[model samples]
Target: MAIWYTADTHFGHENIIPFSGRPFRSASHMDSALIENMWKVVKPEDTLWIVGDFAFGPAAKDMNWLEMIFGQLPGAEKHLVVGNHDGELSQLLPWDSVSQLTEVEDNGKCNVLCHYPMITWSGARKGALQIFGHVHNNWFGSRNAVNAGVDVWDYMPVTLADIERRARKLPINKHWTDVEQRTAAE
Candidate 1:
């Protein structure tokens, strides 16, 4: 099965938060749109790596909602790399949750998975690449990193090409510009 990665779904984030400008008139509408888009690209045998922010609140309150939406997606299995936004996922959801940064060694290359970006100097010691989410933008260093954020569109899953282009440019000295943050929020 092919493995796909994505992050920052923000399912219940309907109204635009002050920090993130995601807009939705209602929670149900946002959830429906997100689910519909996710299923369009995902196949029954495909595996999805949801990096983080699976749900908005307490597990009990959000479990039913998440189950309903996730159940409709066509995927053989789903792996989660927990993010700051996800709360009590193990207690709320049946799926396994990983608390630490995950690493994969493939074809003489190493892949590191985490919710946050590492310091610029950290990339110098890496192997193949490091893929993560959380910063939205303003990634550091030139080792290899990907942003699986909400801005990624449906049907078009994040591709290796996209990741490569962004990853090649690293050691960003400045913080994520306000414009970039606004774009992500939108």
Candidate 2:
């Protein structure tokens, strides 16, 4: 089974269409497109890593949308790193695991996974990669960090290898492990 990563889906958030300039005709269209496009890649045995912002709008109303969307996804297993939009109700959703942050490995490279980006992560100094979703495609906070949100990746989950290749092309200076401490000293 393969593994994939994605975030900032905002499934039922109608405002996202205009705000993000997505071409969907409506929230329903956007949600349907996302689900259909994702199934083209993901399968029943694949592991899907959703970084954050899976849904939005009223708590009770959105809950129903969340249930339907999650249940329809083809992935056999799913992991969630809660985003800003996720609430206490998120705990009620069915997923293999949920957390604010976690670590995952692809081949020989280790990656720090989170809903938001960070300047330095657990193994930043040693070349561990950072995979995040909150910034959408608007920003790439650090060199070693790659934004895995759908807005940046054609609205489908991407593989770890895809992230690693993109991360490798970022400016070398942006990945400096000491940037945080150096900024604080300044």
Candidate 3:
């Protein structure tokens, strides 16, 4: 099955519209768009990984609302990386897996998933790519680490290939040299 990654949906948070300069008229409008966009790319046989901030606001506290959102997710298996906004109830949504930080192997590479972007992650020197959210649209992210947040993307889940392509175009992290030891291959 194909794997997809996304984060910072902020599904029920109304303030996100203005805060993130989202074009949605309302929370309902934003939510619908998010779901529709996800369905367009994610499929029943694929895996969906929400790196962080699945939902927020009062609606997120409602189990029925959360269940409805969870039920509508398009994927045979779903995983959560657990953001700051993900409460205990959000964590109880029957995800295939949930963690504060975890490593996933995709396309013969290890992807380090977390809610907050890190200056460095496990296997940073070994070529592991770090995927994260939480910062919203503040930055586009560095080469080895990328933001999978919906705010960075066009409000949809993205595949590893999409991430890799973007990573290639983006500049290397300024801290790259500071964290990763250089080899004298040059």
For each candidate, the alpha-carbon lDDT, in order, equals 0.58, 0.82, 0.92
Per-candidate TM equals 0.71, 0.89, 0.95
Count of backbone clashes, every candidate in sequence: 2, 0, 0
lDDT of 2 by residue, 1-186 (tens): 888899999888888888888989988898899899889999889989889988876632567757888887778889889999877666468989999999987777778999988877888767788889887768754568888998988898999888877877777554464564445554
Q: Sorted on TM-score, highest at the top, how do the candidates line up?
A: 3, 2, 1
Q: Could you say which candidate leads in TM-score? A: 3
Select the stronger candidate by lDDT from 1 and 3.
Answer: 3
Candidate 3 local lDDT, 1-186, one digit each (tens): 899999999988999999999989999899999999999999899999999999999999998899999888899999999999998888999999999999999999988999998989988877788999999999879988999999989898999999999999989998877867677983
Task: List per-candidate RMSD values in Å.
Answer: 8.5, 3.5, 2.0
Which digits, one per residue and each the tens of the lDDT, describe model 1 over residues 70-132?
Answer: 676557877678888777643256554455477644345556767776543233334346667
Ten-residue stretch with the least lDDT total in model 3: 177-186
- Alpha-carbon runs more than 4 Å astray in model 2: 59-62, 173-177, 180-186
Runs with alpha carbons beyond 4 Å of true place in candidate 3:
182-186
* Residue 90, candidate 3: C-alpha displacement in angstroms: 0.5
Roughly what TM-score does model 3 have, to 2 decimal places?
0.95
Task: Give the worst 10-residue stretch by lDDT in candidate 1.
Answer: 173-182
For the record, the alpha-carbon RMSD of candidate 2 to the native fold, in angstroms, is 3.5
